[model samples]
Target: VYADNDPIVLVHAQTLLNSSAEGRTAYIRADVNEPDTILRSPGLIETLDLTKPVALSLNALMHFVTDAQDAHGIVRRLMGALPSGSALALSHCTPDFDPQTWQKVTDIYHRAGTPVRFRDKAAVADFFTGLDLIEPGIVVGHRWRPSAEDGGAAGEDGGAAGEDGGAAGEDGPAPSDADVSLWVGVGIKP
Candidate 1:
């Protein structure tokens, strides 16, 4: 199941994302601040099997959730509800790399009445505290699991050997790391 609180994005996603014959694609109007509401939602409960491993992806979302909303706690709660072997894939905006530029962006968000918090690497990494991270832990968005042709991240083994051409940016994707200014990683619950 996919969840998004933004009505506009939800509408767009509904039009674009569809279910396949073998599996179903479900969507829910959910807020990251309300873990309990999302966890208990009928759509999610009905579509997903909580007993088995479920992939929870939070791409480019958590940065909007400030510390007061318990960003990490919300993730822990969501992960806590699922059984072992569940996976978490997250990508968050960070000010660690181009701090001046990101801070200006944060100011813009604030001016628009939308509070934003661009976390540093340490804070972003905290989101995966209890899970075991995969290779190239918590690197910039595009650098994570790049196609073998791109040579992967700085020190990656470049072993996307059998990767089905679907790896992120398969056909020459992304700009510099500082340009992206986001942290991404995938972790599996033991």
Candidate 2:
């Protein structure tokens, strides 16, 4: 299901997905913390077949789901709603490489009323419990499945790739781990 707690985000997502020339698309303005809301949404019901596998993408989101909300339990509940063979593609902000920088960033976000809690790799791996991780499990975002140009190696800090279309920028070298602080992985329900 295509869901986001923010109505504006859902509007944009709906617009973008519905614009696709092929395939059916629907949107759900629901919170991830309430897995049943998303799983039972009429929009999702109309768009997807629960009897079949689904591809769930939780990109750049989990870090916002703080421990107070039981983020791991929320993920498990959501994923459990899907059938076997369902895929989960997730990306999360991490403090494993640069705890100081990420901590400052988290404070900034918290001040803005958007609290964030960066996790270590092992903590993020916990989200995929009961699911089989794909190749290059829980690596830096761009290193999950790099092209030949990325040196076919796992990323370390900002040296591997940047969020800006994988370009390191013209003025500086690749980013440091402190700068590019996100981990990504894909997994499948067995």
Q: Clashes in model 2: which pairs?
A: 157-176, 157-177, 158-175, 158-176, 158-177
Candidate 1 lDDT, tens digit per residue, 31-89?
87999889999989888889999999998989999998889999999999988999999
RMSD, one per candidate, in order: 4.7, 3.9
Q: Whole-model Cα lDDT per candidate?
A: 0.82, 0.80
lDDT of predicted model 1:
0.82
Task: Give the CA lDDT, 0 to 100, for residue 189 in model 2.
Answer: 100
For lDDT, the strongest prediction is 1
Error of 1 at 114 (Å): 0.5
Candidate 2 lDDT over 102-144, as tens digits, reads: 8888889999999777899898999899999988777776555
